[model samples]
Target: MYRTARKVAVMGAAGAIGSNVVQDLLSCGVASRIAMYDPYEPGLKGAAEEILHCAYPDADVSWTTDAAEALTDASYVISSGGAPRKEGMTREDLLLGNCEIARQLGRDIRAHAPNAEFVIIVFNPADITGLVTLVHSGLSPSCVTTLAALDSTRLRAALAQHFDLLPDAVTGCATFGGHGEKMAVFKDGIEVAGVPLAEILAGRAVNGRTMSPDEWNAIKDRVRNGGAAIIKLRGRSSFQSPAHQSVAMLKARIECSAYPWPCGAYFADGPYAHVMMAAPVTFSTLGMTAAVPDGDDEDVAALQDSYRHLCSLRDEVIRAGLLPPVADWTSLNPNL
Candidate 1:
């Protein structure tokens, strides 16, 4: 039941992450044609050549400087283009520049690949950039999403290490809200070895060592600061994990499988209106639905804080002239 002759487009396909994304998409073996778009001619050509050398008969790989050429007829689009963050910068610091990039990319997608089933935003400040893209793309919020699961995955790793267990032993780790410092890491939402983290912190010892509340707080801090830690350790922003996770999201969308990871999706109505925030969710060709967490008041408050933080960022973008006010959003894209 494989779909035939599907075209998948990768924006910023020449960069470190984008190149890896290109290869990953090829490995998926779902797309009969893979279109790569990057303005950097040398990098784009080199990436295309390297993949061509592999000679995957299932993929008809093509690179282009033309946005329309790359995007036309694409079934799904993954964008990771924009300036990379440096050591001292927060995700919000990358906002102004990256949102402009996202705005233009969205316009191109609207013009050329309006029917693209899913458009994933992966550059820094993905929540804001994702909102920018969704507004300009003239597509419904359900058709667009952003990569925000890295924080949750980082939290999962921290929990596994704290419990001295294999990573898979930790489950139900969820991160909500923005993908930056303001994200909410819900301890009650996670389990180590199928036991609640809150219970473990209360008294239960795992492997003869109990985790105190302070220890749990430290783990949350580590998850929040994980990206900066990576940049300090590696002298560059992260690429591989983001690339892999975004591609996994696309694959899930195509196969209609449940996505265990959190995704940044639009909230048009409710407490989080006019912002994009990550939440537990399911995806399909039709759209996405963010799950209401079954946790306690603390979880609700933390998620609300993250939502407010994201709203501030979104408002900043609007005020800076990057986008019109929220009232005009529907005018820009009727689908919203």
Candidate 2:
């Protein structure tokens, strides 16, 4: 794949997720300069040194404890902040602390890299935190996004396995709404072997087996609970998949890839108004455009539920004093 030269910054570079993101950025050879920031000097130095050993091509990498130094002149900012989710902990459990972290980090980005074109929030409770960042960073809704693609990728993987096909063969699969358990996984949007999943569910056999509605429903359940399952098996929240997807998002944004990823983007006036949630979005030089999936009535209802949940979370942030009221949003970021 071809890549362009740009100044990229990674927040929390010393953490597990951030280190993996740094490694992927280097290996992809996209940015001309990769700047890493973390308060922990020793871990940051170690992570940078580790990447030095790999000697990936076409990029210069540096580490810093100072946020401004790392972010100044950055073209893109990929940030993973807050603590990782452990077993039995829902994303809501990590909300308040992560909100504060996101608020301060967002202010830092505003103070330092106000001109940066895009930002990706990859921490726990990203839908909420991404909004916090967007508000405080004073960036337009289109300029900042979050890692909703992970849930869609999980959908892709689940469909691939159920159909006995390679992951790449599971095309057009997407989820919309929150990236958490309430996300809407649209079976109608999925395709395997170039055939719509709804067709397969309607007695069109694939791999010599027609899927029953029960099986399709089970797959949807799996997609919704994918993150929790990962923690139960891996003993930590995901890292490798998140790293790959976030970098792929970077590649898509910079290259303007035609494929629209399911991402956590702000919806201002549509059904998901004033909420940052997942939808099918393609990035380009002009900014981002979202096309919410026209799912079935049930799926649409699910999306609405997800939206209400996210709105509640946003209100919680407001009540906690992490942000101003919705009426004041335009004052902080006029583009919103």
Candidate 3:
């Protein structure tokens, strides 16, 4: 039984990221049969038959209206379906709609694909949908993951350009916190081949842009607002970055190799899992098995700040009745 021949399902496969992900998986020989699941039975942009001819012609491809049917015998699920952030829209704007979509899909997965791993690739308010899916699916948080690595990777790109360093040289740096209005990227302890990030900042200048605390803060804020900036400029949310980040996440979940990533994850210490929105986590086959939040002093402080901001958002979501009651590791589960 070749693994690439195994079944994989993609909800909203015709949409932006989903379509490309299915293709990427096929290109990598990850799944044998690909099922494209979309809620809209009619008016779909791409037909499964046609999509296969275009993207994965040699493999078996199926399209269906039923999400459960797609999940059956599936080895992986890359759920890229959700309302994208549009111009003039806020995170809270698409919450209710995406919440319902995620909740329903969670229930379906729980019933049809219990124990199957999932990757949620929706935009801002992913944690909200994550909470809904957690409750509905009752899946261990380990089996369900969200796409926060994109922000972290973005931060890395910004720093790489700022310091005139190669993108691969950014071995350090992680973006943490909610992928909302309050995301945090930690660069304090950043080192390139053992050189401190601050040292690099002091010695290098890029396009006349020097790295200073003020400049760093400004750049970070711009990175946080990068999505909004794109939306405003493009009039609609762009798909390239989302699709790019999503594929990387799929690699993390399936390949489970040691990839250092700055992404959102449920940090399990003793017996409870709290969201670690900002931290360098060594991702492997188990979907974020450990969280190494320990970093340089400034990095650690930034991490603390990131955790605080996440807690604040969690509190607000709970208070607003958007999320169920959440407890830290001690109050929740203690068997990790």
Candidate 1: global Cα-lDDT?
A: 0.85
The lowest-lDDT stretch of 10 consecutive residues in candidate 3 is: 327-336
Best by lDDT: 1
Per-residue lDDT of 100-160 in model 1, one digit per residue for the tens?
Answer: 9989988999899999888899987888999999999999888899998899899999988
lDDT of each: 0.85, 0.84, 0.65
**Residue-level error in angstroms, candidate 3, position 207:** 11
RMSD of 3: 3.7
What candidate 2 gets wrong by more than 4 Å, as runs, is: 85-93
Q: Which pairs of residues clash in candidate 2, taking residues 3 or more apart in a chain or in different chains?
A: none
Q: How well is each residue in 254-279 modelled by candidate 2, as lDDT tens digits?
A: 88886556888887787788888888
Which stretches in model 3 have alpha-carbon errors above 4 Å? 1-3, 42-50, 55-57, 85-90, 192-194, 202-210, 268-273, 276-278, 283-287, 319-322, 327-336
Candidate 1: the clashing residue pairs are none
User: TM-score order of candidates, best first?
Assistant: 1, 2, 3
Per-residue alpha-carbon lDDT of model 3 for 156-186, expressed as tens digits? 7777777677888766767665675566566
